[model samples]
Target chain A: MTTTTAPVRRPTDESQVSVGIAMVFLLLMAGYFLLPIYWLVVNATKSQRDLVTTNGFWFGEFQLGQNLADLFARDDGVFLRWALNSLLYAGLGAGIGTVLAAMAGYGIAKFDFRGRELLFGFALGGVLVPATALALPLFLMFAGVGLTNTFWSVFLPSIVSPFGVYLSRVYSATIPEEVLEAARVDGAGELRIFFTISVRILTPALVTVFLFQFVAVWNNFLLPLVMLQDSTLYPLTYGLFSWQSQVSRYPELQTLTIVGSLVSVIPLIITFLGLQRFWRAGLTAGSGK
Target chain B: MTQLWRRRTLAALAVAPLVALAACGGASTEPADGAAPGSADCAPTGGPVNLSFTSWVPGVEEAVTLWNQQNPDIQVKVNDVPAGNAGTYSNLFNQLKAGTAPDLSQVEYDSLSSFRLQNGLVDIAACEGVTDAQAKFVDWTWSQVQLGDDGVYAVPQDTGPMALYYRKDLFDAAGIAPPTTWDEYYQAAKTLAAADPAVKITHFPQQDANWFTGLLWQNQANLFDISGDQLSVTVDSPESRQVAEYWQKMIDEQLVATNLQGFSPDLYAAWNSGTVATWVSAAWGYSTIRDNAPDTSGKWAVAPMPQWTAGAKNAGNWGGSTTAVFAGTEHPAEAAKFALWLNTDPASLEILNKEGGLYPASSDAQSLPALSTGVEYYGGEQIFDVFKAASGEVDTDFTWGPTMTDTYRFLSDGFTAALNGQGTLTDALTAAQTQSVDSLKAQGITVGG
Candidate 1:
């Protein structure tokens, strides 16, 4: 038998050098992505005086506790009220939206019902619509029903995530139909089949839908900006934006806004870190391996 | 086949009503507070007149409260719209359009014409307490609230008479005296540059439309010539060209820093650090500077703005607001009464000035003993008196056209483009004029020749 020459490893060669370069590039990109977040964290520790004087990226005297205290104390704990509104809007809205999207997506992907394609097409069309253009029409509609300034105005719109449904549909399609058939053969009802068999297998996709809906509802501005006129009803984004607009005349708010931005992202980070495994699982499963 | 088709038709009919009902149910939910009390409630013996006054600042309510203490029958409730220029204006506009506009509204002088165009303003000329007090206000400001044949649509609440606030120590270091004319101002800037390249009279960012409008006003240029609804565009006038050229020269010489757009948090820090040598500010600018740059106390002095022509007046109002009654107000009389108390009452002015940085409209309010007291932050200078001395000279000839706000923005952008060498002064102004005229026409507003 002819012996194939053993390939030599190129530890110092051009190809190896290129790989090293790529690793450095990726590290730099990672740093670039994380820098704003790092700066936000450092900023939260600063006093209003230090905020203007200190380096934007460096930590000054630790005033995170003090800033939180002041933030809650200012205007008689309006920040707490805004935070509660955001949590309700984001947390509960995302939870409900995720389940609805999952069920809709699973139904579209797994069912052989009539007009399924038309229903899928409708869901797809929702993804193409911009949220801003919908705001006024939504406002008009909501105003007619007398819900324009209430929490329902914000929550109801957030709950309908067409993009989330589409993602869930695509993800759910990969589950082997044989498994669902086997569950059905075992005498499980359709709802029980979905809840027990399909849902357990679709954990990764559900997390993705939840995360997306969470962030979408959290960072939403225009809807809340138009929907809520009362200062007492403002979300963190709208409340901070109101303060931001006045920063030119009242510069003290500049620090408050920066600090507010820092504190605002904490829950998002915690959610991501806590649920990172599911995100990874979704990505891996999405590759169809 | 007949049975299946009939079932499908029945299903369609069943769903149609549900969809219509859902659509109907989704829209009826805007929260609207009750409108102000009607004329019936304005009777002296009527229970009370509850009025809603929409404002974006905090201290003005103190003034309202102060007024209410003396006049218990007329009750004013204050709501702070989100601060910042756009939020304040747009929020008010939205409310007005929704027929939920407050009984009294605070309208910026520059935006007064636009507000008047919507036919949403109440004429206060016939209102009690405003007849003799008209002469007390600065002439230019008095005209801002009056439009289209001098229909007095509002009461002047404050004025922003421009003055040069400079770092005395910085000027001393450069061994140059403060400027009194535009030529001397340019020369002084050059002199300062020769001493230290970093120093400038102030930072002028291109994004601020108000600052440029103030300059154009100082140059005696009107954005529009409003005569009988026919508008004549004058943004390409000699005075505008001159202002543009001066700004370009300052930019080429690198005398003015472009960092301060009046929005930067670092702007106050720069002032404290002495990087910015001077700022052309109105009376309202004092509180911002004093509060932010407390470290530079006593080292700063106020002077008249450098005149555009030799021996010409050296002042332009920065920004001022007025109290106006919306046209939809159910209780025009009560609204007018509340606005009058807010604007012209001496006690109200005292309370407002104490709580907020508002310069009172009433002449008697300006003459208050408290205003004459020296400011510790300004090194014992009776700053209000300095502002008062210059407020009267503010030119009343300037007019706010329907497209004045749009034209002002175009001028700011054009000036920036010119300063950055993207185009010549003449070309920039011409383009700005064309763009503004085009925009006005697009909006169905008439422009004069």
Candidate 2:
């Protein structure tokens, strides 16, 4: 037998040049992303007068604590109420959305039933429709049913996440069919098997879907803006926008708006960091399968 | 077969919550029907009635509280909405369409026509003593609240008569006087620019269409005239072009700064640093300037707006608002009484003037000691006297059209383009004229180009 040896390859000069170019591009993107965030952080610590008179990218005075105090104290602590409303909307919306998506996706992927392809095609089409386009029609329908201006108005539409359904389908394909067959043969009920075996396997994917939906519900502004009129029902995004529109008349609210923005970003950061491991595992699961 | 069974069970679980929620959704709860059109009783009922009023004006709550304490039968609850005029109007429009609008809303004079045209406002002509109430307000302001001769739409709350606020120190240093006419104004611009490269004579806020419209209003450029159902728009008329071309000439020579937007930090900084020698503002701007530029106190003075003709006394108005009752209110009588009392009552108007810093549109309230007293910020000058003269000189025939907001937006875009050197001011006016006609037509209104 002829012994054929593979040729050993070395990095070319052009490859090194490309590495340098890639590094430059990455740094430029880093600055582009971080500059606005840096500006927000720097300005959040400033007093109203300093915000107007001082340089935008540098600290003028350390008034973050005072601003936070004012933010929670203004209008009888309405900011806290808005923050809680946001949590309720995003947290519950995402939690429930993930479960529904997981069940639907698992069903469609494992089942060979009539209209299976048609159902999946319908879901794919749903994913193509922009959320904003549905907002007006949804508002009219809700108004017709006397559901507008309620917490349910914001919560109901949020739970119907088509993108989450799509992600869960891609994830459900990675689940092993033989494992489910083995569980069924062991005399376990289907619901029991799903709860015990399938759920454990899908935990990482579920977390991924939850996080995606959570961010979406938290960032949604237009739906809440159009649906809710009672300020008490407002989420942070809508509440802050209402306050910002009055900044020209009430200039003191400028500091409150900046400080409120900084405070609002904390919950999102914690959620992202806490669930980061599952995200990575979920991403690699599909590739491995 | 097992997979199909599991899939059916899963689908049932997925749809259960949505089905439950939809089942729980109750039947439509329509808004309380508004009082019959001609039968709205606007008299105060002896028993207590609750009324909700929405406004962005500061201290309105305090004034309403005073009224509440005095008259327990007519309770008015104040809600503060967003302060932007356009935003407030849109919110009101949405609420009105949804049949959940407040009993009373704060509407500016320029925006009143839009609501009236949409029939969103209730005719308050039958309100107690509303006919005789017209004589209590300034002549020009009184005319603004009236639709033709029979329909009374709102109670005038405040007026903003145009004035020229100049830096006395700057004028003294340049050895130049405040311009009395448009010709003198241009000459002063050139002289001031030649004297100091850093200082411009004034700022022409390209984003402020209201200010530009005020100038047009002063020159007798009747941009909109409605006769019966036919609407005539003349935004690019010769009179308006004359005003635009004059400013265009000053802009070309770099005699005026067109960089700053009104009520912005940059504009405040410019004023504080004395880089802008003059500000063409309304009466309300007096307090704003004083509050913003405290260090520059006693260095400023108010002058009448420079005339288009040397001896003419014609003037224009900018920002002012009125309290109006919505047609959808269930408590029309209490709402109407509250709206009229909020503006015409002495105690409320006094508090509105003293605390809210609102220049009173009521002639009776105009002579309040708070308004006539010399302001220490203006070098102890009676600044309201200048505004008082300007207010009287405002043309009584001036009126706003139904699409004032859209028209202002078009003008702002055109002005911004011109200021950026993409076109001349005359070209911008022409563009605005064409766009305004087209937009008005699209709104299903009859328009004569």
TM-scores across all candidates?
Answer: 0.84, 0.85
lDDT of 1 by residue, A82-189 (tens): 888888899999999998999999999988899998998999999998786566557656766778767898999989989888987897898899988898899999
TM-score of 2: 0.85
lDDT: worst 10-residue window of model 1 chain B: B17-26
Candidate 2 CAPRI category: incorrect
Top TM-score model: 2
For residues B115-198, what per-residue lDDT tens digits would candidate 2 score against the true structure?
766566777778777777888889988778875445678889998889999999988888889998988888888777778888
DockQ of 2: 0.13
RMSD of each: 8.9, 8.7
Alpha carbon lDDT of residue A157, candidate 2? 88
